[model samples]
Target: MKFIAHINIMPKTELLDPQGKVVVKNLPNLGIQGVSDVRIGKHVTIALEAPSEQEAHDKVELACSKLLANVIMESYDFVIEAQ
Candidate 1:
Protein backbone atom coordinates (compact mmCIF):
# COMPACT_ATOMS: atom_id res chain seq x y z
CA MET A 1 0.00 0.00 0.00
CA LYS A 2 1.09 3.51 -0.61
CA PHE A 3 0.37 6.36 1.75
CA ILE A 4 0.86 10.10 1.84
CA ALA A 5 1.47 11.81 5.13
CA HIS A 6 0.73 15.43 5.91
CA ILE A 7 2.67 16.74 8.87
CA ASN A 8 2.55 19.94 10.83
CA ILE A 9 5.41 21.07 13.05
CA MET A 10 4.99 23.91 15.47
CA PRO A 11 6.72 25.40 18.44
CA LYS A 12 5.37 24.19 21.72
CA THR A 13 2.68 26.46 23.07
CA GLU A 14 4.58 26.97 26.28
CA LEU A 15 7.56 28.18 24.27
CA LEU A 16 7.99 31.67 22.88
CA ASP A 17 7.44 32.20 19.16
CA PRO A 18 9.33 35.37 18.36
CA GLN A 19 8.38 35.29 14.70
CA GLY A 20 4.72 34.90 15.52
CA LYS A 21 4.91 37.69 18.07
CA VAL A 22 6.52 39.99 15.56
CA VAL A 23 3.74 39.32 13.10
CA VAL A 24 1.10 39.87 15.74
CA LYS A 25 2.63 43.18 16.75
CA ASN A 26 3.03 44.33 13.18
CA LEU A 27 -0.45 43.38 12.08
CA PRO A 28 -1.90 46.43 13.79
CA ASN A 29 0.78 48.60 12.29
CA LEU A 30 -0.18 47.27 8.86
CA GLY A 31 -3.70 48.48 9.60
CA ILE A 32 -4.88 44.97 10.39
CA GLN A 33 -6.26 45.14 13.88
CA GLY A 34 -7.84 42.55 16.16
CA VAL A 35 -5.35 39.95 15.00
CA SER A 36 -3.64 38.31 17.95
CA ASP A 37 -1.72 35.25 19.03
CA VAL A 38 -0.15 34.57 15.70
CA ARG A 39 1.95 31.46 15.23
CA ILE A 40 4.27 30.18 12.54
CA GLY A 41 4.88 26.57 11.69
CA LYS A 42 6.02 24.20 8.98
CA HIS A 43 4.12 21.74 6.86
CA VAL A 44 5.60 18.60 5.35
CA THR A 45 4.29 15.94 3.04
CA ILE A 46 5.85 12.53 2.47
CA ALA A 47 4.95 9.65 0.22
CA LEU A 48 5.91 6.11 1.16
CA GLU A 49 5.03 2.49 0.71
CA ALA A 50 3.92 0.50 3.73
CA PRO A 51 2.16 -2.73 4.48
CA SER A 52 -0.58 -1.04 6.42
CA GLU A 53 -1.84 2.33 7.53
CA GLN A 54 -0.55 1.67 11.04
CA GLU A 55 2.88 0.92 9.68
CA ALA A 56 2.85 4.09 7.61
CA HIS A 57 1.84 6.11 10.63
CA ASP A 58 4.63 4.62 12.72
CA LYS A 59 7.21 5.32 10.07
CA VAL A 60 6.08 8.91 9.73
CA GLU A 61 6.14 9.30 13.49
CA LEU A 62 9.71 8.08 13.55
CA ALA A 63 10.61 10.49 10.78
CA CYS A 64 9.10 13.35 12.72
CA SER A 65 10.93 12.37 15.90
CA LYS A 66 14.25 11.69 14.25
CA LEU A 67 14.42 14.44 11.64
CA LEU A 68 11.37 16.50 10.91
CA ALA A 69 10.73 18.10 14.25
CA ASN A 70 12.69 19.08 17.35
CA VAL A 71 10.81 17.41 20.15
CA ILE A 72 12.37 19.67 22.78
CA MET A 73 10.96 22.90 21.35
CA GLU A 74 8.48 21.74 18.72
CA SER A 75 5.56 19.34 18.52
CA TYR A 76 4.22 17.46 15.52
CA ASP A 77 1.22 15.56 14.26
CA PHE A 78 0.41 13.84 10.99
CA VAL A 79 -2.39 12.33 8.98
CA ILE A 80 -1.91 9.48 6.56
CA GLU A 81 -4.12 8.87 3.55
CA ALA A 82 -4.07 6.48 0.66
CA GLN A 83 -2.73 7.82 -2.57
Candidate 2:
Protein backbone atom coordinates (compact mmCIF):
# COMPACT_ATOMS: atom_id res chain seq x y z
CA MET A 1 0.00 0.00 0.00
CA LYS A 2 1.08 3.54 -0.64
CA PHE A 3 0.50 6.20 1.95
CA ILE A 4 0.93 9.95 2.01
CA ALA A 5 1.64 11.75 5.22
CA HIS A 6 0.96 15.41 5.77
CA ILE A 7 2.94 16.78 8.67
CA ASN A 8 2.93 20.04 10.54
CA ILE A 9 5.74 21.22 12.77
CA MET A 10 5.36 24.19 15.04
CA PRO A 11 7.13 25.87 17.88
CA LYS A 12 5.82 24.90 21.30
CA THR A 13 3.12 27.33 22.39
CA GLU A 14 5.05 28.09 25.55
CA LEU A 15 8.04 29.25 23.53
CA LEU A 16 8.38 32.60 21.83
CA ASP A 17 8.26 32.68 18.05
CA PRO A 18 10.53 35.53 17.09
CA GLN A 19 9.78 35.41 13.37
CA GLY A 20 6.04 35.29 13.93
CA LYS A 21 6.27 38.18 16.34
CA VAL A 22 8.24 40.21 13.80
CA VAL A 23 5.52 39.68 11.25
CA VAL A 24 2.80 40.61 13.72
CA LYS A 25 4.63 43.77 14.68
CA ASN A 26 5.02 44.85 11.06
CA LEU A 27 1.55 43.95 9.80
CA PRO A 28 0.23 47.38 10.78
CA ASN A 29 2.74 48.98 8.44
CA LEU A 30 1.13 47.26 5.50
CA GLY A 31 -2.29 48.55 6.62
CA ILE A 32 -3.14 45.18 8.08
CA GLN A 33 -4.88 45.22 11.42
CA GLY A 34 -6.96 43.19 13.87
CA VAL A 35 -4.44 40.37 13.83
CA SER A 36 -2.96 40.02 17.23
CA ASP A 37 -0.57 37.11 16.69
CA VAL A 38 1.20 34.93 14.16
CA ARG A 39 3.22 31.78 14.28
CA ILE A 40 5.40 30.31 11.57
CA GLY A 41 5.70 26.60 11.06
CA LYS A 42 6.68 23.92 8.57
CA HIS A 43 4.57 21.57 6.52
CA VAL A 44 6.02 18.35 5.18
CA THR A 45 4.64 15.71 2.90
CA ILE A 46 6.04 12.21 2.74
CA ALA A 47 5.04 9.36 0.48
CA LEU A 48 5.96 5.84 1.41
CA GLU A 49 4.95 2.24 1.08
CA ALA A 50 3.43 0.53 4.07
CA PRO A 51 1.31 -2.50 4.74
CA SER A 52 -1.10 -0.66 6.97
CA GLU A 53 -2.17 2.81 7.99
CA GLN A 54 -0.78 2.26 11.46
CA GLU A 55 2.60 1.48 10.04
CA ALA A 56 2.60 4.57 7.89
CA HIS A 57 1.64 6.72 10.81
CA ASP A 58 4.40 5.27 12.96
CA LYS A 59 6.97 5.89 10.28
CA VAL A 60 5.92 9.49 9.88
CA GLU A 61 5.98 10.00 13.63
CA LEU A 62 9.49 8.62 13.77
CA ALA A 63 10.63 10.87 10.99
CA CYS A 64 9.18 13.90 12.69
CA SER A 65 10.65 13.11 16.08
CA LYS A 66 14.05 12.03 14.81
CA LEU A 67 14.77 14.42 11.98
CA LEU A 68 12.01 16.79 10.90
CA ALA A 69 11.16 18.49 14.17
CA ASN A 70 13.03 19.56 17.27
CA VAL A 71 11.32 17.68 20.06
CA ILE A 72 12.42 20.11 22.74
CA MET A 73 11.40 23.28 20.96
CA GLU A 74 8.74 22.11 18.55
CA SER A 75 5.71 19.85 18.37
CA TYR A 76 4.41 17.87 15.44
CA ASP A 77 1.41 15.94 14.16
CA PHE A 78 0.63 14.12 10.96
CA VAL A 79 -2.19 12.55 9.03
CA ILE A 80 -1.76 9.51 6.89
CA GLU A 81 -3.93 8.80 3.89
CA ALA A 82 -4.04 6.23 1.14
CA GLN A 83 -2.52 7.48 -2.05
Candidate 3:
Protein backbone atom coordinates (compact mmCIF):
# COMPACT_ATOMS: atom_id res chain seq x y z
CA MET A 1 0.00 0.00 0.00
CA LYS A 2 1.09 3.56 -0.66
CA PHE A 3 0.74 6.21 2.00
CA ILE A 4 1.16 9.92 2.29
CA ALA A 5 2.45 11.22 5.57
CA HIS A 6 2.08 14.82 6.62
CA ILE A 7 4.30 15.70 9.50
CA ASN A 8 4.56 18.82 11.59
CA ILE A 9 7.27 19.58 14.10
CA MET A 10 7.20 22.51 16.49
CA PRO A 11 8.99 23.88 19.46
CA LYS A 12 7.64 23.00 22.86
CA THR A 13 5.28 25.50 24.50
CA GLU A 14 7.82 26.38 27.18
CA LEU A 15 10.29 27.32 24.45
CA LEU A 16 10.33 30.73 22.79
CA ASP A 17 9.54 31.08 19.09
CA PRO A 18 11.08 34.32 17.88
CA GLN A 19 9.87 33.92 14.31
CA GLY A 20 6.30 33.15 15.31
CA LYS A 21 6.28 36.08 17.71
CA VAL A 22 7.45 38.41 14.98
CA VAL A 23 4.76 37.18 12.63
CA VAL A 24 2.09 37.51 15.29
CA LYS A 25 3.16 41.04 16.14
CA ASN A 26 3.16 42.09 12.53
CA LEU A 27 -0.04 40.37 11.48
CA PRO A 28 -2.23 43.22 12.72
CA ASN A 29 -0.33 45.65 10.56
CA LEU A 30 -1.01 43.39 7.60
CA GLY A 31 -4.77 43.59 8.41
CA ILE A 32 -4.76 40.16 9.95
CA GLN A 33 -5.65 40.42 13.59
CA GLY A 34 -7.19 38.48 16.44
CA VAL A 35 -4.76 35.69 15.72
CA SER A 36 -3.16 34.99 19.04
CA ASP A 37 -0.63 32.47 20.20
CA VAL A 38 0.81 31.62 16.80
CA ARG A 39 3.70 29.22 16.79
CA ILE A 40 5.95 28.29 13.87
CA GLY A 41 6.66 24.75 12.83
CA LYS A 42 8.04 22.58 10.05
CA HIS A 43 5.96 20.50 7.68
CA VAL A 44 7.17 17.39 5.91
CA THR A 45 5.48 15.29 3.29
CA ILE A 46 6.48 11.68 2.93
CA ALA A 47 5.49 9.15 0.31
CA LEU A 48 6.19 5.56 1.17
CA GLU A 49 5.08 1.99 0.72
CA ALA A 50 3.87 0.14 3.78
CA PRO A 51 2.02 -3.01 4.54
CA SER A 52 -0.62 -1.28 6.63
CA GLU A 53 -1.66 2.04 8.08
CA GLN A 54 -0.10 1.14 11.38
CA GLU A 55 3.17 0.36 9.65
CA ALA A 56 3.12 3.64 7.81
CA HIS A 57 2.44 5.52 11.01
CA ASP A 58 5.24 3.72 12.78
CA LYS A 59 7.67 4.54 9.99
CA VAL A 60 6.75 8.18 10.08
CA GLU A 61 7.05 8.27 13.86
CA LEU A 62 10.44 6.71 13.68
CA ALA A 63 11.56 9.18 11.07
CA CYS A 64 10.39 12.06 13.22
CA SER A 65 12.17 10.72 16.25
CA LYS A 66 15.37 10.00 14.39
CA LEU A 67 15.70 13.02 12.13
CA LEU A 68 12.66 15.19 11.68
CA ALA A 69 12.41 16.63 15.18
CA ASN A 70 14.45 17.33 18.25
CA VAL A 71 12.73 15.25 20.90
CA ILE A 72 14.15 17.32 23.75
CA MET A 73 12.86 20.72 22.61
CA GLU A 74 10.36 19.89 19.90
CA SER A 75 7.29 17.74 19.41
CA TYR A 76 5.85 16.16 16.29
CA ASP A 77 2.47 15.16 14.90
CA PHE A 78 1.56 13.37 11.69
CA VAL A 79 -1.35 12.15 9.64
CA ILE A 80 -1.23 9.17 7.36
CA GLU A 81 -3.50 8.82 4.36
CA ALA A 82 -3.86 6.42 1.51
CA GLN A 83 -2.37 7.64 -1.69
Model 2 has an lDDT value of 0.94
Clashing pairs in 1: none
lDDT, model 3: 0.94
How many residue pairs collide in each prediction? Answer: 0, 0, 0
Runs of candidate 1 with Cα error greater than 4 angstroms are none
lDDT of each: 0.96, 0.94, 0.94
Query: Least accurate stretch of 10 residues (summed lDDT) in model 1?
Result: 27-36
Whose TM-score is higher: candidate 1's or candidate 3's? 1
lDDT tens per residue, model 1, 1-83:
99999999999999999999999999987799898699899999999999999999999999999999999999999999998
In order of TM-score, best first, we have 2, 1, 3
Candidate 2's TM-score: 0.95
Candidate 1 residue 30 C-alpha distance from true site, Å: 3.3
My TM-score estimates for the predictions, one after another, are 0.93, 0.95, 0.89
Residue 8, candidate 1: C-alpha displacement in angstroms: 0.5
lDDT (C-alpha) at residue 17 in model 1: 98
